[model samples]
Target: MQQVKAGGLPAVSTNLDAPKTRLWGERRFRKAAGSALLLCALLLLVSLPFALIGPSVERLVVLVLINVAAVVGLNIYTGNSGILTVGHVGFFAVGAYTTALLTTPPEIKADSLRHLPAFLANSNMGLGESLLIVAVISLVFGVLTGLPLSRLRETSAIVSTFGLLVIVNFVLKGATNITNGTKGIYGVPELVNLPTAYIFVFATIAVAFAYKVSRLGLQLRAFQDNEVAATSSAINPNRRLLEAWALSAVVLGLCGALFAHVIGAFQPHDFYLTLTFELIAMLVVGGKRSISGAVIGTLLITALVEIVKPIESGGGIAGISFPPIWGLTQILLSLMILVVMYKAPAGIMGSRELSLSMFKRPRLSESTIDVASLRAVESRSERPAATLATNAIGIDFGGVRALNDVSIKVETGKIVGLIGPNGAGKTTLINNLTGVHQPTRGQVILDGQEIVGWPSSRIARAGLGRTFQNIRLFSEMTVLENVVSSALARGHLATGVESYALSLLEHFDLAKLADTKSSALPYGAQRRLEITRALALEPRFLLLDEPAAGMNPKETASLIEAILSIREKFALGILIVEHDLHLIMRLCDEVYVLNKGEMIASGSAEKVQNDPKVIEAYLGSQEVRAARRKKTT
Candidate 1:
């Protein structure tokens, strides 16, 4: 292994073998192999009963597997992005129609799709060629829809996607030449069967699972948990959401192709609201976050539907005859969804995967500090000093000025303190600096480049990192994942990232709880983890908003030590917005005090402490301050 020195730290190995890299690879491979095996076993277990049962049961299994494939695709986007999509079935319809038009005999297309263009009407492609074409078309649609959808959040995004579905449904019904209108295209080749459906199910499961564990998915999930925090850590929410959206579109398209081949004929209504609701219910009930959940939920819902479907058709149970109940299955399914939502909002698997570890006790081991990896990170941080400064920044909320003429500068290796009482606009100033809010006027210069109006992700990538006053950890993720996601967002090499994250966790004494979910951590630990996550960005300047807010005396003292150590080790410029005067007095090289959105005092800590304006702002009224000062003297 080649070694390179980093400042006063020991030499870091730049070779692949440095710091348990090989061991990590082996563990990762084992886990992946184990998961793959488990999936195969599950497929076999599910197929066993259907295989032994009559052909009728076998057909139902095939349909269930296909539904599972479609729902898994939906989960890839909706589950990770936390953006519920009502339009995915539109992509499914696209796949079904595209494949149907392509693979259908040219004669059939000529009669049914008389208005279709010559190319599609004459096309008589095989299943493979049809599917490839479907994938490309689905990708185009995914990108087009995702561009607008990714920019929205919550109800707006959801409603926008539903609009997409309505538009697609309308297009399908109106475009008679292309889609055969409401009658739909027929004579699609029956190329998918039990084994064929199983193949696609396996592929879908693998893809969804891979995405769930990939860095991009981690960043998306982080954004889902806390948008401001993720963006501050350099995660581009739109890009991640778009990627997942496109991928899921392709998967859903393939599932539609499989469905077309299975049914051999279909109408536009086949892929409309009925199918959309069924797939969504399957995903929600199973657990939207896990591939295992998708499969489990599909199977459970399919069984329920099968059992209830007989009664809906007027079939007697136990030889007891009853009147047919129209929409009985739909009513029951709706009730089941309501119960699941109220009882288990996260679904069956929540954010967890079904793995071999679930069947066995996890072996806990102390994480050893990887010195070489730590040094590698330190080497990356070594750079010329840069300044992050705001020049006469002003912010307005309607007629109210939140901040006016606020200017602050932080250098590469100094700790600057920003202090103010409640509603003094301290946090607002930090917000402008971090790109959470654009200032009405003034410039933010980073290393001499004007960066006002830049996105938070861009600001973070430009080497500025920050923490929120209220903790914003990816609560659903593990402590280690929270840090690793930030590192990955900053483009850290995947091979070395785990070791680097472990080193940071060790620095904060959080390595032992690395596997624990961040939400499970105590308040102080969550605060430290936020700092650790920001440090993973390897930023030149860090903006910490109230890091000492809720820490007890001991935690605050430890936080001071950690902050000081970080500044010395990484040569970082730290701007801390804190109400904790003791921390400011102990750690700040310079203090800037704000009162009523304006800079009231700027000097050493002692000077600011004694400033009359600062005293009056905190204690209220000139008379009261003077009275207290006279009595003290």
Candidate 2:
């Protein structure tokens, strides 16, 4: 069971049960389409009953659908990208104003926007034409605003977006000739009715669902869970976040355009904080992670608003009136949000999409890749070997040197061991080789290309994959997803990733638990999963940091066997940083020992084991030990 944190977002358990989508198949597309249609039908059913009551009720239903479109758009960014934004309604305002100015009659435009630029001043567009323009403009706006904020931490992103909100509101309020300031624009053509709203709402639902299962969406969620692991998988976090933000903006823009027409007229205040707060409340209360949650929250809250407004105005059911209750809707919403924060932080549905999990059929997806086909690729004649070499590479943190004049090389189809006592700079050297740390004074050459200062993601794409000293898994994701997401780094290879990931799982003896959440896996399995995920990058040289750190002798033996098979099958060069001297001595072809951030010995494992300097580093000098013992006595 997932626990909700104080802020209403689920804790570590949030991603434990995310729906797994089968990549590139009719079955997957069919399921998604069926789910969307089912949701649309439910909305129609709810709205139709209210239509028989009166036109006001029908209009209310239309408004609710528009809000659903807006919140679903917001979920694309705030939910998947894990950024809280108060500025989407700013895009809504942009859409509303853009549509109103473009679609209004030339006579109205001349009066209201006399100072408008010639290009915008003369054109009179229909609702459809105006909406098309609004979508493009909002996307551009989202990209521009989201790009700079993409790399920021959560608090910074929130502050930047809130500032964006203020800037947009300022523009709308001050651009009097165009937006007519606080007086608002009048005569926005009423082009959206119940039928039109229904069409757009369903369209939004379909698009959102499609995006949720897309490669981009999966990568975004991976970044959300663990940025470092995502980067190691060759996923560029900032670019993916920008894509989500822009796509969500397009949806919000479309909704805003629809809302403007439905209301027949609107002001800046109509799309300001009031609207922003309401939309955010809906997303949070419904659950930020699911599209269905967005729809449900919008419907429930819209009904609450309607119900409370009548009570606030002293209207009653069947002629039983009561005193006016000011801000009752807002008060009730606040209470509901508080309750949700404590009780069901993941919102109503958590990470689950609308599905048949309740029917108790098999949950695990069987491997679809032919084992023979995978083995055939693995058995092909080995390609030309690649090499990773560092020459006198050094890095300093402030005044302390983490790695000093460290040089190392690993050729394809070999295993090299990095061994040192505590603070001996083994991991630091690995970081330099893998582009995590820029060498202060030397060169990192991969396949003869100088990669000393490249970003980690670029280096990863250049055929370098590494695991962390501490196991870093996409804990909320299934084991299969962890591998498949990494495989997607190959671009067009995404469709075939599921099979490849399954093959990797099978190699590591994790085939049966492929559908299990990574967090739920046994310790050994999680470690194996991390290695499998790294291998998904298909790197020419793989770096394993403390792979056998906590493993028992039996588990280490299995790991050693797996490493041997991987080397023979893929012809990969492996660099392992481990304290398990026995496993290292058995598995590594060559061993390098470090003392005081300097390489002190390098040779065959047997030679290094007997080297006098290596022994001195491991067990302090005789004179030093004698002095220490004398002091203790």
Q: How do all models score by TM-score?
A: 0.93, 0.90
Judged by whole-model lDDT over C-alpha atoms, candidate 1 comes out at 0.84
**For residues 49-84, could you state the per-residue lDDT of candidate 2 as single tens digits?**
987699887787788889999999999888887788
Q: How far out, in Å, is residue 194 in model 1?
A: 1.4
TM-score, model 1 to reference: 0.93
Give the Å error, residue 410, model 2.
1.1
Which residue pairs does candidate 1 place in steric collision? none
Write model 1 residue lDDT over 1-633, tens digit each, in one string: 222232222111245455456332234345655675686578779776876698777777788888988988999998898888999999999999889988899898777777778888888999888999999999999998889888999999989988989999999999887887888778998887788887888888777767777788889999999999999999999999999999999999888888898888898888788888888899899888777788888888888998888899887999998789999888988998899989999988776667857655434343343433443334434668899998999999998999999888899889999998999998898889889999999999999999899999999999899999889999888788899899888877787777767667777878778877788888998999999899889888989999988889999988998888788777889999998899999999999999889999999999999998898899978888789899999
Q: After superposing candidate 2 on the true structure, give the runs of residues whose Cα lies further than 4 Å from its correct spot.
A: 1-27, 117-122, 311-328, 358-376, 623-633
The Cα local distance difference test for each model comes to: 0.84, 0.81
- lDDT for 48 in candidate 1 is 61
